[model samples]
Target: MKKTAYITGGSKGIGLGIAEALLKDGVNVAITARTQNDLNEAEKHLKTIGDAEVLVIKSDVRNLADEENAIQQVVDKWGQLDYCIANAGVGKFSSIDEMSEEDWNAVIDINVTGVFNTVKSAIPALKKSKGYIFTIASLAGTNYFEKGAAYNASKFAIVGFSQAIMLDLRSYDIKVTTIMPGSVATYFNGHTPTAADAWKIQPEDIGQMVVDLVHMNPRTLPSKVEVRPAVPPSARK
Candidate 1:
């Protein structure tokens, strides 16, 4: 039976790349995001990559109801869900004193609470399938830096949360892994990828990692993974 996967924020960047990889493996995939236009574009592009079925859902991870409904849609369409990637997140950078309440809340709400909702809503389905869960975190989760107060706090929370849940869900035969990546060449933070960004990790790299993990021996679980560029730009200079 072909496994089914669901990805949040799968309209672009890492999410889209993951979807393409899974699709190539013949996994039926459902991808969700808040924007209909982005989803439409993603759907079109994804279809060209693989023959696997693709389901695009318009969902906002911050809303529990929306997440619940999105999962339900996946289960309803695919009949089973073998994997879920809670890749929906946001980053807001600013010093504590300079950060607006709105920006702080948005960061926490989307990055932390969003994953909670996505995972919580998918638990019942995953339990039945003994599936896998992947959360997209960042190196900043552990390393603190200036102007990263809000973003760091959220990613840090995700790393801890994903680890705790890995323990909680293991008995159910479900695997949870958190991927902390450094400097991916994506449209994240409103930064367009240019030639200068070639040195950064590409989204497809992360996608390939997920595929490898899914194919790993069931007895061995890599619960936490940290990825960085092989050679940073500074090393060349």
Candidate 2:
């Protein structure tokens, strides 16, 4: 049977790219997002790619119940899950003094809590299959910059959480990895991915890395991967 993967925020961006790559490799994929329209559109695009089974679920990952339901939906359809990608995250840029509590909460709730819920809900099935768990974090998880107080905090928390889980799940032969990407050309931050952004990494590049990692020897685990653009645009003096 083909391996099954559950990817949160798979309706677009890096999540969608990974799903597409896995589909081409004959892996079944279940994708979740908050919007039904987005899921529907993603399903259509996934179909064009390959023969892999594609399941779409509408879910808001911040809600524990929703995350559980999404995982259950995948298990019901696919029977087992071999991979879990907690890629759903949100970001807001603001100085610490100007950041509102609501903004901070929103970032934390979606980035930190959402990842927690995704992993918690999928752990049972993952333990059963001895599967792999990959978290889509940011370079901010380790590096900080201005106007990134809330976003940085959330990502930093994710790195620590992911590393701890890696240790916790190692006994089960379940691998855990945190992928921290610096800059990617995607429809993130209200900007659409474009050729002009070729200098930055592409979503598919990350997808390919996931595929490679999955195919590695079981005894080897690359716990952390930090990726960045080879060259970044600089302001003219």
lDDT of each: 0.95, 0.94
Maximum-TM-score candidate: 1
Instruction: Give lDDT: candidate 1, residue 164.
Output: 99
Instruction: Give me the displacement of residue 59 in model 2, in angstroms.
Output: 0.6
- Best candidate, lDDT: 1
In candidate 2, stretches whose alpha carbon ends up further than 4 angstroms from where it belongs are 234-237
lDDT of 1 at 33: 90
- Tell me how candidate 2 scores on lDDT: 0.94
Q: On a 0 to 1 TM-score scale, where does candidate 1 land against the true structure?
A: 0.99
Instruction: Estimate, for each residue in 109-167, the C-alpha lDDT of model 1 and write its tens digit.
Output: 99999999999999999999999999999999999999999999999999999999999
Tens digits of per-residue lDDT for model 2, 33-128: 999999999999998888889999999999999999989998999899999999998889999999999999999999999999999999999999
When summed lDDT is taken over every stretch of 10 residues in candidate 2, the lowest stretch is 228-237
Supply the global lDDT for candidate 1: 0.95
